[model samples]
Target: MSAVPNQAGSWSTLETPLSEPIMETLGLLGFDAMTPVQAGAIPLFMKNKDVVVEAVTGSGKTLAFVIPIIEKLTRREDPLKKHEIGALIITPTRELAQQIHSVFSTFIDDHPKKDQLTLGLFIGGTTTLAQDITTFNQSCPRILIGTPGRLEELLTRSQKIVNTKELEVLVMDEADRLLDMGFSQQLSRIIAQLPKQRRTGLFSATMTDAISELVRAGLRNPVRIVVKVEDLTSKGSVQRTPASLDINYIVCDPEQKLIQLVRLLQAELNDMEGARKFIVYFATCACVDYFYKLLKQIGDLKPFSLHSLHGQMDTKRRTATYTNFTQLPPAVPAVLLCTDVASRGLDIPDVDYVIQIDPPQDPKAFTHRCGRAARAGRKGKATVFLIRGREETYIEFLKLRKIPLERGYYRLEDGSVCDNVLKNDDAEDEKITTSEVEDASVAPFIATLRAIVKKDRDMHDRGMKAFVSWARAYSKHEASFIFRLKDVDLGRVATGYGLLKVQKCPN
Candidate 1:
């Protein structure tokens, strides 16, 4: 079934009416209507049936499971003890887990029986295992949310501290990403310990064979719900991303990539009506680190709030950055430079644009990345920066998957690319003609980047590492036919990285 916007479905429309507290909380959260996934899956979950929900990101998959979990716990005939968990939600990343936990908190906090129900977050890096165990023992959270590794460890090593005999619902959020990240073994172990009669829901944006195997193993005669998005551009065609998302791609020389990005960001910052929150995706953690530093040094971007998030950062830093970015005021113009770690299952509010410095190696991730914007029927835009030539074919590759793309242009001002850029579908707009390497602003920007790497040994080392990691990641692209590493120009790629010089990466 395809997901309809909030208008078509409402909380009041559910067959088994939600508890009064749940209804009141939904009203407080401003959720006037149910999304398609919510409308479809909520009733099945309420009926105590296992569900496999495959929906687009930002289609309100969180609430589809969250509400049911709350409803089940609240209506339980046997009240759960403090340490006895009733529902367990396992997502792939800590950020996603945190987001889900927040949603649970929103409903739990407002419910009249909020005091009776408790919530716990057990992801790694935020706290030590001993600390988590202590909290679990003390608080006895009724609903537990965590990542697979920590949840597996907690369930396996400290069974006494983490009780699951009463576990009522088990959810694998972003189920496909869990398998893609090689967490199948952990998921299997976690599932084995849970009671077979418990409700199990596997929620993901894209369904894969591995997820099907997981469903077969974990769920019992589950009802499958696929919430597809209708493509507004073409009739009778389905889109993986939201209809409100405008996906565009920009083709530029390798050396001009950074200049193009800086100019685009500057343009966005200057546009009062444009997006204030931006997510810039880098190919690797090293790239995020290097670019985060590089972009911070640029004079024009200094006034805007710039932050970086990657998988390598310590738990506290990652949690802090995620919290900081999410809580930023709507009026503040902020940009989060991150890797694909920030891509899936994270609901950052009012994200105006998602800029991909490069396409992800995984094809499915493209949909997830764009889903960050244009979420929940809100207007959003995404543009990927691709190198000219063969990389341009990626556009067609995505088209084959029903992901449409439009040409993204570089907006220029006074003979150089400037703000108010990447507004597609305007044929009368003047195209940028300045040679990227020779452009007045771009030439100075590239020089400054090179000089920073040359003068600072640490910065220089970071650039080299980022370039090599990027190349290695590109070589392993799922669509290697298009993003072939050998077809790349090492010299120009190095120039694009602002590296002091190119050096062969040791195999």
Candidate 2:
């Protein structure tokens, strides 16, 4: 079953009304109406049905399951004991788990029965297993939220302290990512331990054959909820991304990628009316680390606050970075250089732009990466950087998947030094093509980067690592036919990375 694209029903409109506390909390949270996903799935969940929800990111998938979990627990005849878990929410990443926990806390903290219902977070990066066990025993949290590895360990090891005999709901948020991250074994083990009679909800942005297998095993005869985006311009076309999101792509030489990125950031920073928050995606963790350092040293980008996050970072640092970026003030211009770690289910407020320096290894991730912006019906823009030759064919690959793209243009006033381009045209026509902008900015920016890297040993080593890792990652892209490693211009790529020499990439 699919939700109507424009459905925005009130919380009270469900067949079974939610408790006063939930309704009151929803009002306080400024959620006066439910999005289509929430409106469609919440009623079924309330009626005790297994739901497989495939909706775009930032469509409020969190609260669809969250509200049902809270309502079902509150309506239970037998109150959950301190040690008994009423609901278990497993997501692929610690940052996403933390986000869900924060949402639950917002409601529970305002509820009248807040003392009776408690929430516990058990992702194991910052805290040890012993600490989690201690908290579980002492707090007797009724709801549990965590990553697969930590959840599997806690569920199997601490049976006495972690009771699920009364478990009512099992939600796998980002179910596709859970499978992508190779958590099938962990998910299987966790499912075997849970009560077979519980309500199961598997939420994801996209559905795959692997996810289908998981649904068969984990969920009962499930009701599939797909919330599709209607293309406003084309009557019969349905898009994977929100209509509010403006997705554009720029084609540049391999060597011009970095300077083009800097130019875009400069443009966003210069636009006084635009939100200063931006998310820039890199191909690998090494790239995030290298660029995070490289961008910090650039004189032009110094006005923006820079942060880095990747899957390889420790739990504490990743969580801290996510929190800091989400809480950044609208007045302060900031950019987050990250891997797909921040792409899936994060809802950073007022994100004006999402810049993709590298296309994701998985094509489906393109939707999620862009979904980070233009969320909750808000207007946002995303631009992906594609190299000029075979890599440019990726645009067609995405088009086949119902994701349309528009050619991106750069404003001449975006600090481009290209004097050859016309400067006296109308405002609409003053924009320059990617090549013109790249031609003007590439040589000087590359020289400056090389000089900076030559003087700093750490920067030199980081550039080499990032280049090697990026090449390997490209080789493994799902669309190998289009992103063939053999077609890459290694010398130009090295120049883009500010490397002293082109290094050999590992097979």
lDDT tens digits, residue span 1-507, model 2: 655547678877788999998888888878899999998889899889999999888899999999999889888888887678899999998888888999999999878777667999988888888889998888888999999999999988875578888999999999999999999999999999899999999999999999999998988899999999988889989999998999988877778888778878887777777658899999999999999998899998999999999999987788789889888897899999999999998878888899999999999999999999988888999999887667777887899998989877543434654323234553342222223343655678899999999999999998999999999999999999988888878898999999879898866
Off by over 4 Å in 2: 2-5, 410-438
Query: Best-fitting candidate, measured by lDDT?
Result: 2
* Clashes, model 1: 3
User: Which numbered prediction scores highest in TM-score against the true structure?
Assistant: 2
Query: Which portions of model 1 show Cα errors greater than 4 Å?
Result: 1-7, 159-161, 413-441
- lDDT to native, each model: 0.85, 0.87
Worst 10 residues of 1 by lDDT: 427-436
Q: Give the true-structure RMSD of model 1.
A: 4.2
For candidate 1, give the lDDT of residue 430: 32
